[model samples]
Target: MTIATLPAYPPKPRPGDRVAVVSPSAGLPEVFPRPYELGLERLRRDFGVEVVEYPTTRKMAAPEERARDLNAAFGDPSVKAVISSIGGDDQITVLPYLDRELIRAHPKPFFGMSDNTNLLAYLWSTGIVGYHGGAVMTEFGRPGAMHPLTEASLRAALFTHGEHELRPADTYRDVDRDWADPAAFAGEPPMEPGSGWTWRNADRVAEGVSWGGNVEILSWLLMADREIAPDPSVYDGCVLFLETSEDMPSALDVFGILRAMGERGLLQRFSALLWGRPKAWSLESPNSAQEKVRYANDQRAAVLRAVEAYVPSIPVVLDVDFGHTDPQLVIPYGGRIRVDGPAGRVTVTY
Candidate 1:
């Protein structure tokens, strides 16, 4: 979309403001109360925001019920912001039930990622910018203390306005512990030294409004013909950011999705691209550290392959700390992003 037609950035919430916790995706909090409670405590203690939960915040209710809670949260003037407990696989099912007119009338800063990309994309279509990180169960309720980088980025996204620079994390963790086990909450997850960000075609600077989210979710959205504009050029001059979930789809799958987007004439419209670090390990696929590195390399290669086919010269930064990786940074959907390849810096206007 052109700058004149870009979505409006919702007002940021203050520390004392009340924020709604809803389950637009999955009610993971019900299955894992310890982490959910911990996340709530941190939201109140660390962030100083009062927590207001909806009916389906902890229960795996029907799609309409989840959508009702979402509408209630946004329609309630007392709620200044809304956050998801966690993301799930079938958030796309919840979209048809949402009251877009209600949400558009009462816009609130919404925070989530993964399956919540459905909501982020919905909000974007409704002319409101939504955050793509800071899910309660994962980031806010992180085992032990929250990651400093994550907290800083979340804080800026929640309370401040204007530009916020994003820095590469020196360390990150992808291996997840069993949230069902109390031991998992005993301390922070183990992390390894990070290789920093990989920049491609970064010889110049590019700035534009940002778009995109979890790659898998975007593919689903495309398949469903959901929130994406019919005109591929709506994303022209936009900064596209994408990440993978814990499902760990093969590199072939990643390339296939991007190839489809390129075939649709959607991939070439962006001025820059930011790829979130892929989660190389999961419970089902507990890859070795070496295997993790190889998986990441393959994923990166798949992305580069697609980039070569479309928008090859655009600035591309990979392995950004977002999505399923530990210490995730909040990326503002439908907000301003400046990608400076020559300066080796990336900044997002919160």
Candidate 2:
């Protein structure tokens, strides 16, 4: 999708604009109100934007309800933007019930990540550029305080229009703290110093529209054939950005999914890739410090193997902060991405 053909990025909302916060996926807000409330508080105090919640924002409701909230939020002139309370696994279910024509007529900036990727991809296909970052419970309500990088990225996406250069976090944390414990909100999570971005085939530059989201989520979309363009050439000059979730699918599993895309002649369509830092630790798969390091290293290798198999010459940047990791960047769905290997810079047009 070229800039001309890609959806027009919806207008950025003003500081006093009312923004809708809905749960288009699982209602973790139902169980974990601490983070959700803190997130909403920040939306008002920090962002100076009024927050609006729907029936399903903090409740486990039907997909139909979630879609209706989205319609109402976008259809209302007072509501300038909409964001998710958090992402969930069943956002794909809500997609079927969404009215594309209604949404197409009332395009508003939508911010989210993880399984909200379903909605981002859906919005992209329907001719709207969605923000692939800023889930309320996660990024905004990060314990202690939000990361400066995350705040800057979110603000630029919400308030400005221009090309922004993406940078690797000086430090990052992939581990999670139990939200159920009030103590968890008392301090920031541990952070490890970053080694910076790893680049391959870094002799040239590639510029195109950015595509792809959570790697595992993309596998789901591929299987469902929901919003992915059928023609290979549709992504001919795209920059594919992908990341994994806290589930931390095995290195082999990672390769298998990318390999499937490779076999379908999909892997080679992009001129470059922005591979996000893999989330290596979760409550269920808690690993030793050494194991976490090894997990990230192994997944990086798996990603390289798949890319090497089909697109060895394309520039690939690894460890970009755009997925489940802390201090994440807001990537523009169906927006321009410039990967300049020689300059060692990745600039995104928002």
Candidate 3:
């Protein structure tokens, strides 16, 4: 199998740039108006970026229409960047309708996570690096103000280049404050203290191109054979970043996916694995602190089991901040990533 070589097209946006905000998935703006408004406001005030919207950006429209908006955003030269309001589950359906030539022609900075993973992978296929964080509603439109860590990471991702070191947030929040309640915007939420990252089987530092996204999403990509390279060697020595979503998939399910990747000759090709902090609890299943800790630990163990079984030599870093957790850090898909196991540090070159 031959690995797919990604094209290189840089899309850098400065403050005061015109950025388009689109909803490629569910239009939560229709349901939750407050956060949607707050998100738009912050994009203007905080980032000093003009927020543009398309017809389907805030509508529950057909998949083809959503694809059209995405293509239009990339096709327009004045649009310096494109961001998603939030992720939805059905973005996979929008894949076929997207115009690859249009996206490739413009190649602007695109930011999203979760279901937007579909678009990120698509952008990768077009050779443009896409950011995997900072949705308008979720990150920018947090009930309170945006998390400081989130803001800092977003700044680095949007404005800077070269290698940027990633630091775990000193504290974190996972509980969702009501968007409709105006009082929720009064202040930041209470946060629990957190320890730094946990390293596994550290030996040598490794640096390579980064890949992987929400693990469940990646499974869907694999099943669909979307943009993922068939040749495992294309991922040779690359860093693998994986995270779970709010759906709170079981540890067994997590392991099963990695096991399948191992079977596909993918697990052995990477030099390091960066696991995102697992979102153990959601509105649907609110686990206790102890339960959440146990769930995260169990999931980490499951990932370790798969690594040991398939690629024991690969360095593993657990609980780096990304995915559904609060104050999530943005990761550059298809960009360069460095993992220094000896120093217990990781950095990405955007």
Candidate 4:
């Protein structure tokens, strides 16, 4: 088995161009009209882009319906890019119904994360590069204002085409506010001071094609074998990055997933693993400030335990801003990235 073919970056949209806003996953927009509308308004006012929503963009719909919206969005020449409304648990359900050939024939930039990872990996298999962050509802429609890091990273991904260096965010927010409350939009949510990334295992540079996504989502895909190739070699020499969602998998669960990947000869294929800054807190399972730090520490320890057992020499960077954290960075789904451990820096070619 060999590394799968690298995907071509689809056409980028220009200012004032049209972009598709589809909900291939859960349509949270219907329930959270404030955030959804704010996100759309930002696209128009801040980005100077017009959004065209499909029928499934705002409410619950069948998998077939979502797939059709995806196909319609990608196939339309007028739609320069496609962005998700939000991620949901059941996006994997739409995979079987996707028109792969149609998507391949008309490549367009697709932006999403979390369960949207399902679609990103699917696009990767089809040799079409999709973005791994910047869902409309979260980043664009962020209360008060967008995080500087997120806004910068997203702008670069959307408008530029070249090597872009990624830096550690000076601060981050892992807590999610109540989106249902109108007051949540009145001011910026509280944020705590953050330390930058922690590095281990090596002091040399590692560069390769990129792979991996939400660890939980990947687990679901592994069981279904939806977009993953039969050959484990497709991930060879890739710079793998994985993150956790707010549901908050236990440390044991994290190690178990990695161990499973290792058993499949997939874990050791990566040159390095970028462990995204885990969402240590969620509304459903809110922890005290001290507990939040403790949770993050335990998660890191679990990751180290898995790596030491599976790929001991692999350079691993912790607390990268690319997951369910405030000020997320948009990593290219199947793009190239360089991790210079010696300099403690990571750069991605957009």
Candidate 5:
């Protein structure tokens, strides 16, 4: 299907406005209450937004129930925004049950990332812009405190309009802590110095509505032939931003997926590409610091390998501080994004 017009940016919520917290994915709040509770406190205290929780926000529910809560949140006039508690593995199932017309009619800014990408894409198809970052359980519910950059970006996305410039975080981290342990709440996670962004073929500027999210989730969408446009020109001139999750697919797997996208003519459709900093460390694969560096490098290499075979001349930026990283920046999915390769800057319209 061809998207005839750009997606509309929903009205931003104010500090004291009510926002619905829903669990469209895994109900991690039920299993790990500490972080979830902390996140809620932060949302109320730090952000000063009144949070309304759905019935399935803390507990696992069937896809239909999740969809019902999402529809209710959107349909309510009092609720100014909707945010996910945390990302999970099966939000795609919830998509089939979503009332697209209801959500499209009651347009409000929606915030989520990782597996929540499914909803982002769905919202795009419905012609509403959605945020590609921030979650109550992760960003707002951070341990000691929220990262300064993250807070600033999210605050701007939530309450402000117009262009907000994107900058590289001075430091970043991907190592996860035991959310179940009380001791983990004592301080912030350890972070190392950042390497900044790596730009490739950045001789020109690319500006358009941003698209894409967690690469793994996008791969699933592609496999299901769900939200992607049948006509490649539908994405022409748009900025493509992608990031990986904690699952951390191998570099080869990353390349394989992008290769598949390239084969589908999706790669060449974008004006530029923004690669979020890969989450290098996870409990399942605890690599040494040196190993983590090597892993990231390999992933970047794989990305370039795919770019070379497809959209070789397009501008690409790597290691951007979004996705599953310490200090995440909110990208306005389906909203305007200006990537100035010459100036090494990125600005998003919220």
Candidate 6:
């Protein structure tokens, strides 16, 4: 069978656009009120966009109801885009209940990551371009204020058009301060010095339609066969972007998943890979400064080993800022991605 070409869904958001914010996953706002409120305020005041919330936007309801809210948002013609309030673990369950025809008929930009990967993949399958970053509560709803990098990236993704070069942020943060404590906004989280992109096996530049998401989430997609095609040719010349979740899967787990992709002939097809910064630690698995550094290094090595074994020529960029970490950058699924392996530059056509 011939593999289908990746669909290109044009960018939709603009300043003064009315975007619908829904909780297709866990309703974190009902639990964590501060960041949720801040996220809403930023959407209105900072971006100059109107924020519309659905009935189940903050309700911890069943997957069917969440899917209903998604359909309602997309069905409304006035809504320019849809943004997730936050991500949850079981968004996979909501897949079966989604109205694919409705979503396809009204393709609008959807922004999210983590568990929202489920929705992103669903939208992609329906020929919609979904962004893979900037959840309402996390990035826009940042406690002290939005990171400069995050704000800049979101602006381009929302209002601007054409080729947007993605530069690595000079510094990054993952830890969250207390949203309830107003004093927590007194200072920004400490950021360590970061280097430019590290390219592996950089021999030539390659450009392709981009795909892939949180590695752990993609594994779930693989298991369910939700959106990912079984044939490797579907991913041929595609730029793959992947990052680990807060679970911080061990190096072995990361290797095993890639090994599975290799076995499926998926690894060898990608033109290039953008590996997101592995969230070294989270609140549950808080590690020392030294340990976090080690963890990130180990994860990188594991990915390199898998690529070397399966797709040695594909250039791999380490520590891209898109995944379970703070100051996340949005990636357009089924969109144009340029990887200049020699110059060590990456640009996305939104």
**What TM-score does candidate 3 reach?**
0.96
Task: Work out the TM-score per prediction.
Answer: 0.98, 0.97, 0.96, 0.98, 0.98, 0.96
Cα lDDT of model 6 by residue, 247-304, tens digit: 9899999999999989978888899999998888787888888999899899999999
Candidate 1 lDDT, 1-350, residue by residue in tens: 22236788998889999999998999989999988999999999989999999889989899999999999999999999999999999999999988888998899999999999999999988899999999999999999889999999999999999999999999999999999999999987898898899999989999998899999999999999999898777888999999999999899999999999999999999999999999999999999979998999999999999999988999999999978998899999999999999899999999
Cα lDDT, all candidates: 0.93, 0.90, 0.86, 0.91, 0.92, 0.85
Candidate 4, residue 193: how far the Cα is off, in Å: 0.8
What would the TM-score be for candidate 1 when compared with the true structure?
0.98
**C-alpha positional error of residue 262 in candidate 3 after TM-score superposition, expressed in Å:** 0.7
Q: How would you encode candidate 2's per-residue C-alpha lDDT over 65-88 as one tens digit per residue?
A: 988888888788888899999987
What 10-residue stretch in candidate 1 is worst by lDDT? Answer: 1-10
- Model 3 clash pairs are 7-127
For model 6, what is the error of residue 39's alpha carbon versus the real structure, in angstroms, after optimal superposition? 0.7
Q: Ten consecutive residues with minimal summed lDDT in candidate 6?
A: 1-10
Clashing pairs in 1: 1-234
Query: What's the distance in Å from true for residue 208, model 4?
Result: 1.0
lDDT of 3 by residue, 1-350 (tens): 12346546376889989999999988888878778898999999999999999998777888999999998898889999999998989998999999987887788888999999888878877788889999999999986688888898888888778777889889877766777678877887778887678888777898887888999988998998887776667778888999999899999999999999999999888989999988888888899999998999899999999998999988888888888998799999878889998888899876
- The number of residue pairs in model 3 that clash at the backbone is 1
lDDT tens readout by residue for model 4, 171-256:
88998889999999999878878789999965888998888899999999998887887887777889999999999999999999
Using lDDT, rank the candidates from best to worst.
Answer: 1, 5, 4, 2, 3, 6
Which parts of model 4 have CA positions greater than 4 angstroms off?
A: 1-4
Cα lDDT, model 3, residue 25: 87
Whichever of 3 and 6 has more lDDT, that candidate is: 3
State which candidate, 1 or 2, has the greater TM-score: 1
Question: What C-alpha lDDT, on a 0 to 100 scale, does residue 330 get in candidate 1?
Answer: 94
